[model samples]
Target chain A: EPEVTQTPSHQVTQMGQEVILRCVPISNHLYFYWYRQILGQKVEFLVSFYNNEISEKSEIFDDQFSVERPDGSNFTLKIRSTKLEDSAMYFCASSKKTETQYFGPGTRLLVL
Target chain B: AQRVTQPEKLLSVFKGAPVELKCNYSYSGSPELFWYVQYSRQRLQLLLRHISRESIKGFTADLNKGETSFHLKKPFAQEEDSAMYYCAFRSYNTDKLIFGTGTRLQVFP
Candidate 1:
């Protein structure tokens, strides 16, 4: 079965530095999403993308966060500046329709 | 606002015993409900969806609009059923999933 794939299984960055988390969703899926989970916390939605544009975003997805589909297969999440709180497991998901999303293994981001 | 609630953090049952993982949701509009499971060292995967109304690995969940719940249940559980299960909700026109804290099911042999 085809599955979503993410690069840099684990990332470490300085508090004020920028970092990009990359994902390649299931090839045929049209909708993509980003979600995060703090250690010991529930998974929280960050943003959703379709047609190369953001469909919806949560309060946590502030100015510091941006998503891009720079290429056909690559969906990337960029954080302009990282903070201690930014450390978490970030997951990328995609679906053919609006339901039944498939998730990647997740990238563990550690902002020092 | 949409929120999913899984009250139980951990549940353990012996092999061949029945299991039930409770899930409740708070959403004004009709929403799609799903159960996702993650085994140790494995990625999250969809176990079942309410719309399908089908059983997967002896598990089934009924969507109760009156109580706003979609609890997952399985009869004659096997030891392989051990994993972390999350109850999720997605509203219309949205691709984002709102997940609950999750329940860790440990099926003892």
Candidate 2:
């Protein structure tokens, strides 16, 4: 079965540095989303995207976060500056319609 | 306040035993409920959704709107069924999932 794929399975960056996490959702899915789980915490939604624009976002997705579909097959999340609290495993998901979503292996981001 | 609650952090059972994972939600609008499983080294995968009203892998869940709950159940558990299960809730037009912390099921032989 075709699944979502993400790059840099693990990432480590210094605090205050910028990092871009990449994902390639299932080729035919129209809706894409980004969610993160801090260690031992519930997975929290960051943002949802469709038609090259953000559909909805959470409070945690503040000024530092941005998402882009720079190409037909790629969806990317960029964090302008990292903080210690930013360390978490970020998952990318997509769906053909809306509710049921498929998830990627996830990129574990560790901000030092 | 939209939230999904899986009260139990861990549930253990033996082979051939019955299993039930509890889940409750708080949402003003109608809620779409789903169960996602993540095995030891695997990514989260859909187990089943309440709307389907079908059983998968001998497991089934019923959406009790009156109780505001969607609990997953299996009459006979197999060792291979061990995994982390997350109960999720979504509102129409919300497009995002509100997930419970997750329940880890350990089915032993």
Candidate 3:
């Protein structure tokens, strides 16, 4: 089966530095999403994208965070300035329909 | 605020024993419910959705409107059933998934 795939399975970056987490959603899927899970915490929604624009976002998705579908296949989350709290497992998900979403293996990002 | 709760951090069961992972949600309107599972060293994958009402891998979950819960249950679990299970919710119109803290199921042989 086709799966959502992310690049840079793990990343370590200094605080205040910019970081870009890339994801290639399942082919033919229309909606894309980003979620994060802190250690020992629940997974939290960050943002969702459709039609080249963000469809919905949570309060946790602040100015520092931005998502882009730079190409037909790539969905990228850019953190302009990373904070220590930004360290977490970031997951990318995609769906052809609204309800059933497929998730990627996730990118473990560490902002030291 | 919308929330999904998985009260148990860990649930231990011997092989062939029944297993149930409790999940509850606080949503005023009806929301779609889902269960995702992640085995050791693997990515998270969908296990069941209350909407489908189909049993996959011998696991089933019922959406109890009265109790505001969607608990996952399996009659007999195998040692291979050990994994981290997460319960999730999404409003009807949007696609963002709100997830619970998750419960780790250890089915011992």
- Kindly list the per-residue Cα lDDT of model 3 for residues B54-75, writing each as its tens digit: 9999999999989999999999
Model-by-model DockQ, in order: 0.89, 0.92, 0.91
TM-score, every prediction: 0.98, 0.98, 0.98
Which pairs of residues collide in model 3?
none
Off by over 4 Å in 1: none
Candidate 2 falls in which docking quality class? high
lDDT of 3 by residue, A1-112 (tens): 8889999899999999999999999999999999999988988999999999999999999999999999798999999999999999999999987768999999999999
Q: Stretches of candidate 2 above 4 Å error?
A: none
lDDT (tens digit, per residue) of candidate 1 on B44-91: 999999899989999999999999999999989899999999999988
The Cα error of candidate 2 at residue B1, in Å, is 0.4
The DockQ assigned to candidate 2 is: 0.92
| Interface RMSD to the true structure, each candidate | 0.8, 0.6, 0.7
Pick by lDDT: 2 or 3, better one: 2
Model 2 chain A weakest 10-residue run by lDDT: A95-104
lDDT of 2 by residue, B1-109 (tens): 8999999999999999999999999987888999999999899999999999889899999999999999999999999999999999999878999999999999999
What is the TM-score, restricted to chain A, for candidate 3? 0.98
Docking class of 3: high
